[model samples]
Target: MFENLSERLEKSFKLLKGESKITELNIAETLKDIRRALLDADVNYKTAKTFTETVKQKAMGQNVLNAVKPGEMMVKLVHDELAVLMGGTSTDINLKGSPSIILIAGLQGSGKTTFTGKLANLLKTKRSKNPLLVAGDVYRPAAINQLQVLGEQIGTTVYTEEGCKDPVKLAKDGIAVAKKGAHDVVIIDTAGRLAIDEQMMEEISAVKKAVNPDEILFVVDSMTGQDAVNTAKEFNDRLDFDGVVLTKLDGDTRGGAALSIRSVVDKPIKFVGTGEKMEALDVFHPNRMADRILGMGDIVSLVERAQEQYDEEEARKLQKKIAKNQFNFDDFLKQIQQIKKMGNLKDLAAMIPGMGKMLKNIDFDDDAFKGIEAIIRSMTPAEREQPSIIDGSRKKRIAAGSGTTIQEVNRLIKQFDDTRKVMKMMTTGNKMGKMMGKMPIGKRR
Candidate 1:
């Protein structure tokens, strides 16, 4: 994400590579390159110029402290300015009211529906809120159904009325239903138009007036670049949305929308849609984003994702099984599934503090456990519980039945045994492991 812009900014900083102090001349050269990089990345030209001006003034005015080098100082100054430009701090979704109403607004194909589902899941799991997803997109039956499937996947109730043509009424009734069901959050997914049309604007505005929503999030496709900023402005002018949701940030987004939207509309970016999964939503932090733009990986977010996926109950249950020596193929497969659900393997692997640059070209399949899963599926219940029951002859038969070579099956068993040993160490001496440890297994393997 923003790789091109990251590369460009890194090059701009090189102008101060070996300088003891920043001068106006070197700062001018660096700011010129930075301005061009921003323009190339589809940032608003005027905003880019203003950004460089701020950066340059600060670089020239600041006393280059003895503790930091010129390059480090420039990076720090630019990072701070970028954070302020993108709204100095994160703004959380307002869920204060009983059955707090959240209205989703955006253009067609802006991923409004997907984002609604994701937001509902986030509220339910992360915030411990009982959320009711409301289908307010009456224009498309498919849109309602899509939301239904997402609600089903997340185990949330969806409120919808058949043939309800009025989105305002649907949203009102949806909130009523949420209140009746003791839900704490109500997320209404509103309709979107192909472009910023009058009808679309009026429809969403009516919903806003009727519901008196606590939060109205304008979802914009980051890939839309400048158009995203303009659309945000249009929506904010009409509904005065509380925050912005930038979707499709995982793709080759030109960074313009993110850089300009806040400065343009004066609304903090509440969250970003990094991927299509319900688990892909992240609260936007300006300082953290600035770090990512400067090629520093987001380790904080990476750790949070892991913590969310690691269930305490499941860990305790597995630990008991390990002590009893009852850990089996089925348990190992379940662990793999849990890890895959956390996120994309390649992206998650790149989040370790020092592993991003190293794993850039290494291809790690999330489905690397597919063969092992198949092999385990072929085994009988007894064999799964007791691998020793599958001797040499049994292994040959299992391999043939599972459509894998005997050697491949043997490798999986050996890997599983090794994994158990490592897990025992992790559970038994967790503190010792943290203090005297090597890298995570993912990195070493």
Candidate 2:
């Protein structure tokens, strides 16, 4: 996700290293490099030029503080400007009307259907809105079926006519169904062509005119880079979309669409599709994204994800169990489940400051926790409650049951024991602090 651009920008900032102040002379090379970095990331040439100019003007005008180095000051200026380029702040979708209508439009293969499902799931779970998914794609084969599957997976009713060829009528009837069902929102998934055509544009226009949707979201595949921005502009010209949805952002995207679409289309990026899962949709936040691009990480989003899966009652009970030294394999397994529910492992890791660059070379398997989960599941309930009861024979049996080796089981047990000891120390805060104080410097481990 803009890894190359981030590296280039970091290198550009290094141009100011050891400089006394941000003079135009010292900053010329850095600004050039920053502009080149943006261009390489497929940003609009004009936008890139304008951004660098704005950054330079601000850098030269501001008085640098003694505590802040030239390089550090430059980075701060670029970060804020990048945020402004991406829309300055997040924009919420309008849900003002009763059974608010949201029209989804895009070129074919833009993840329109998938994003529709994700949006429905987001509104249903987060906003407490009863959403009705409407399958408006009648031309494409199995488009309706695909939406139906997604609707079922998200536990939302999908409104589809068995053999309706008229998308405008389908959308209209879908909204009617929402009103009938007392649904708070109606998301109509419109059809798309491989390329934009007059017929396609006209058909979508008709639907828009008929429905008078509260929001029309133009979804685009972010991996397409500048093409995504161009497609968004074309769609906006016809439909005047309310927002943009950049899908497949978790892929190897250069991030041009996210950075350029807002400025080009004059619409805020309302959402981003980070992964394939229905729960992967995120409300686009300019500052957080700028932080990610600058390798600053997004700790606020990380905490928000954790809080979503957090349960106050369960947390209090877990704390008590840890304080009493009663945290067991079952509790450990439950903790793993909670983490897994938070979203993709690598995505979560990237939310931590500095972890993105550190883990960029590592490949995270979707089943990364499978072995540990299997091993824990293989244990008897009694053994899970009291792991000390497991002896040599029990280790062999559990390893065989989990399709693992005895050494693997032994390694897990060692790790678990260490984790329990550390957890106990953490619960006893002063004791843990004193232990840290007693440890020899540079030999703490």
Candidate 3:
């Protein structure tokens, strides 16, 4: 996501490479480079100009010490400015009021329906809200069905009225059903026009008036760049949307929309659609986004992903097995499965601090453990428990059973042995324990 814009921004920063002090001349050169980068990313020219000018003034005002290198100082200054441009802090979706209603609006094919599903999934799974997805797209049966499919996938209930031409009524009826069903959160996914039209705008406005929703979220396709911001402004003018949802961010978006939408629409970007997966919705974070655009990795998000997958009782059992030197390939495979549950491998890899920079050009797969998994699955129960007992003859048999080579089977045993050794040291040496023990701490304690 935004890889192209990230690349362009990185190129701009090279103007200060090997520079000593932040001279006005070199700074101006770098500023021009940054402006060009933003323009290339499809940022509006005026917004791009104002941004660089503000960045330039701030860069010059900073008290640069001899210890601070020009390049490093410029990076830091740009990061600060970028954060401001993207909204300085993450904003939460306002789920206030009993049966809080959040109305989703956007142009057709802007990923409005997909975002609605993702948002419902996020609220139900992460926020622990009993969310009912209200399908208001009466024009397309497929649209209502799409929301239902996603609702099923996320284990959330969807409310829809078939042949209900009046969406305002559909939404109202959906909420009434939700109330009876004991749902606390109601997300109304409204029908979208091919483009902004009088009929569609009025329809959405009517729904907004009828529901008086707690949050009116404008979802826009980030790949549309400046147009996304412009459309957001139009929607905000009509609905007075509470927040923005930048969708299709997982696509080849140039990063212009995320940077410019908030400033243009005067609304906080509350969430981002990082992928098509229901779990891909992320609460917008300005600082982390800045780091990502600058080719710096986001360790905060990486740790959050890890914490999301951490189960204390499970961890305790695994630790005991490790300490007793009984940690087998099955445990290793289960650990991998738990990590996979957190998120996409590519997305998780991007969150690792500095890993994105190192891996920008490489094609990394989430199934990096596939070969290991196949080999382990082919192993007999005894071999799984005692990998050391698998001799060369056993290796050839496992390889044939798993449809892998004998060398691959041998490599898996060696790697498994090495992993157990590391785990034993981590469990007994108190290194891993100290780290896990110092977590935010369980509230029950």
Candidate 4:
């Protein structure tokens, strides 16, 4: 998302290359470039100035270790400052009340409804909370229906009073229903106007007072740049929200709002909406985000996503199968499904250090596994369990069923067999030489 800023920052560091230390004389132009990069990214002018100034101070005061290059030292200082500029640490949403009331407030097109559903999914899956979604956006037609659709997708309950025009009353009543249903979390999605207005402000403010939410989150569209910051300020003045939620971050966002909102409103960003999926909500981590912005990649977050999809019991079972050389196409298909659950293919690849730069020009299609999955699905159950049983005629039949060439089917079988052999050798701790000897030597005929 900060692709332009990352490139600019990289170039700025290059200005300090070949320098022995970060002296004022040598660092001035570098700092200027950094500030310009921030401004071009749509960061608030004052924030950009303060950030660069603080970074310059830190860079100048630090001792340059012989082991570390001057450019590398400057990068470290800027990364730390960027983290501080973006709230210094991640904040968790408050879910401490009897039924934690989370009121979502934002502009009409800011993705409030979608975020509500995502938040519920997060609580249900990660936090183990029974969340009840309340469709309180009565002013927007079909808003309630949209939330209901999301609720259904996440398997959460949506509490809506059809024909009830009073959002404040609806919110209050929704909380009551949550109490009766023993729902531990109540997320109330409120109405928003095209722009901030007296009626919109007063209405949400009244609803806040009525419900006394445990957490009031102002969702903003990150693509709006500085306008998002201004809207956050106005909302904070009235609602005094607990934290901010930046949505549509995966879109064509300049990333100014994310880098500026916390500083402008003096609030932590609790979460960010990365994509359209209900599982796309991520708890904001400032240091990790700083890493991503600097093109350093976010390995910690990548591992966490992998852990979320990891099943210990399943791993044990799979290990046993691999040890016995029984890692067939069905097992391979399950592994692909686990990877797919981790998120976007390109995004996942970007999490690995250095992969982002390598894939910067590559268009990673999300459906890259479609062909493999289709081929596997085309197999008969018996063939899936016993892939070796497939012969020449079976290959032709599978190719036609999967809409692929017979050669493609043979290639997949060859790949699967080679993968199984490699995995078996690794699990068995076979010597490197022996493993290489056991590897398949030629292409499938």
Better of 1 and 2 by lDDT: 2
Local lDDT at 78 for model 2: 97
In terms of TM-score, how similar is model 1 to the real structure?
0.89
Note the clash tally of each candidate.
0, 0, 0, 0
lDDT of 3: 0.85
Candidate 3, residue 146: Cα displacement in angstroms equals: 1.9
lDDT of 2 by residue, 1-445 (tens): 8888989999999998999888999999999999999999999999999999999999989999999999999999999999999999999999998989999999888999999999999999999999999999999857889999999999999998988999999999999888989999999998885335988889999999999999999899999999888878878888898999999999998988889988888899999998988888899999999999999999999999899889999999999999999999999999998888788999889989999999989999979899999999999999999999999999999999999999999999999999999988788998778878998899877
Candidate 4, residues 1-445, lDDT tens digits: the string is 8888888999999999898877999999999999999999999999999999898878878888999999999889999998999999999988889999999999988999999999999999998999999999887768889998999998999998878999998999999999999999999998876445888788888999999999999999999999999989988998899999999888778899999998999999999998888888899999999999899999999999999989999999999999887878889999999888788888888888778888878888888999999999999998999999999999999999999999999999999998888899788775766766776888323
TM-score for each prediction?
0.89, 0.95, 0.91, 0.95
User: Residue 287 in candidate 2 has what lDDT?
Assistant: 98
Q: Model 4 has how many clashing residue pairs?
A: 0
Extract clashing residue pairs from model 2: none
User: Residue 365 deviation, candidate 2, in Å?
Assistant: 2.1
Q: Quote the lDDT for 409 in model 1.
A: 88
Best by lDDT: 2
RMSD of each: 4.6, 2.9, 5.6, 4.3
C-alpha lDDT (0 to 100) for residue 161 of candidate 1:
98
Clashes of 2: 0
Residue 12, model 4, lDDT? 97
